[model samples]
Target: MQRPKPAVIDRATALRYMGAAGWQPDAAATALLDKAEALVLDAATPRAALRLLPRSALPTEGQGNDLRRHLEGCSHLLLMAATLGGELDKLLRRLELSDIALATAADAMASVLLEQVCDALEAEQRTYFLQQRGLYLTGRYAPGYGDCPLALNDELCLAIDTVRGCGLAVTEQHLLSPRKSTTAILGAADHPVTGYRAGCATCHLQKKCAYRKRGITCADS
Candidate 1:
């Protein structure tokens, strides 16, 4: 059975996410990250009866066009879900002042948290892929990035039962919960992996990258 290794988050990334919410990574935040990591790891380990239907499986011309135009050459789809415990719900309620406010906050936080979680998961998955001489990740390609359609969230939610299992449901507008959760697609290839440059050029928000603006350099030099 395929098991997802533990989710890892660096202190810096945790700080960044907390900062976005106007909250500093106090003792409470540190404690939360530690607990969240454990919870995510435990949840990720269980295998769900899930299938990743390819772009070909989509029925509509618009969807086909969306996949062909955006997700061309994409080969694999990984679907994962976990039941959201009361703790997550409590966190969401505490952070969100109102429905609209919560939605807005969730949109931003979800992307950050998801990116960190996916990075950790992909690192482990890449190791496995390399051991098998199969494929390794180039980088994660998420919806609403590089022309990938955001509309695919519905498909992802259905594929993984994001609502029933994860307590994460997509609104009519397609946002996730815990105000800091995420789902994404990653590109994999059989080629030997190259280290991700910690430079502006390699960044997804290269042109207007906040990390760059904050003088965060991922460059080896």
Candidate 2:
């Protein structure tokens, strides 16, 4: 297990999460965002865990047609889960009650922070697998993306003991409990991974995405 330091956050990414990526933040908005960033970071307790399992570990059915396609040609699977922990969730709730505006900004900032944590974990594991096992990883594909059922999150969390390991839990609606937590599956193979969609094409949110409407992408965000 490892945790990424929440020392920085990408403003553009946070803006994207706030659905204001296309507009420039005025001083007030900027200051609010900065405050949100500080609050989110101060409340964050990042933690992550990774487990590499044989491809056979996945059930043959109900894993989603697209997910199976995504894992094609891969011999192994990597289960990853990460969280900013319960303190941030509590902070967001407090802000929600006292200042909804700051709560909104803090929520977006927290999303970016969680994304960074996942990215850091993936990068570290990618390097390790490449150097030690001569493997390459496909981009992460999470539950509820495309045809993948969100229910898969429960199995994934169980597989990695997420609750015990990092205080992460799955809700009745299949959402991560902390609300800032995430779990993903990555395919590992001997050859370089290809056909990974880092764009909006396969995104479940593409239909209602602000970035797509503006003819841009949150890929880099």
Candidate 3:
């Protein structure tokens, strides 16, 4: 595991996460977001871990058709976990006690940072496998997408040793702890992969997403 360099958080993405994407921020709101962004950047400590396993090695009991289809034509799966660490969690909690609005901004910024970290990890592995073994990676699919069971997070956590490697934890409720972390699965194939999308089309929350309600998509930001 290697520490990823800090990334500049995208303001639009952060606003989208906060469900305030289209709303114009007043001076007070702008100041609040500025403060929260600074705190999130200061507190964040990015870390990531990845593990590659043969597709057949994964247990089959709970895998859904959607996931199976997503990995079709692939011989191996790449499991990844990434986080902004627990210090960001502590900062968010403290802000929650004093200013809910600021806390909300911080949470959104943290989410963006975590996503950036995951993207970087995925790109890193994609290049590694391509150059080292002539394999290409399918777009990542995570637990809780479509019929993919949320319970799979536990298995994923253990498979990748996310707890010891990156300090990422999976709760009994299937949530990732440090409160700002993510896990994903990517398939490696002998040929180039396609037909995967990360926007509203593939998201399980499509019908209820705040972005959709605003006539936009997460990818828009």
Full-model lDDT for every candidate: 0.47, 0.85, 0.82
Would you list the rank order by lDDT, best first?
2, 3, 1
Ranking according to TM-score, highest score first: 2, 3, 1
TM-scores of the models, in the order given: 0.52, 0.90, 0.88
Candidate 2, lDDT over the whole model: 0.85
Candidate 3 C-alpha lDDT tens digits along 91-208:
9999999999889898988888788777777777889999999999998788887667888999899988998999999998999998888888898898997524444565679889
RMSD of 1: 7.3
- State the displacement of the C-alpha of residue 90, model 3, in Å, after optimal TM-score superposition: 0.9
Best by lDDT: 2
* Structural RMSD, model 3: 2.4
lDDT of 1 by residue, 47-123 (tens): 22233444345332353332333343444544443223345445455445554443333433433445544555666
lDDT over C-alpha atoms for residue 172 of model 1: 73
- Segments in model 3 whose C-alpha atoms lie over 4 Å from true places: 22-26, 195-207, 215-221
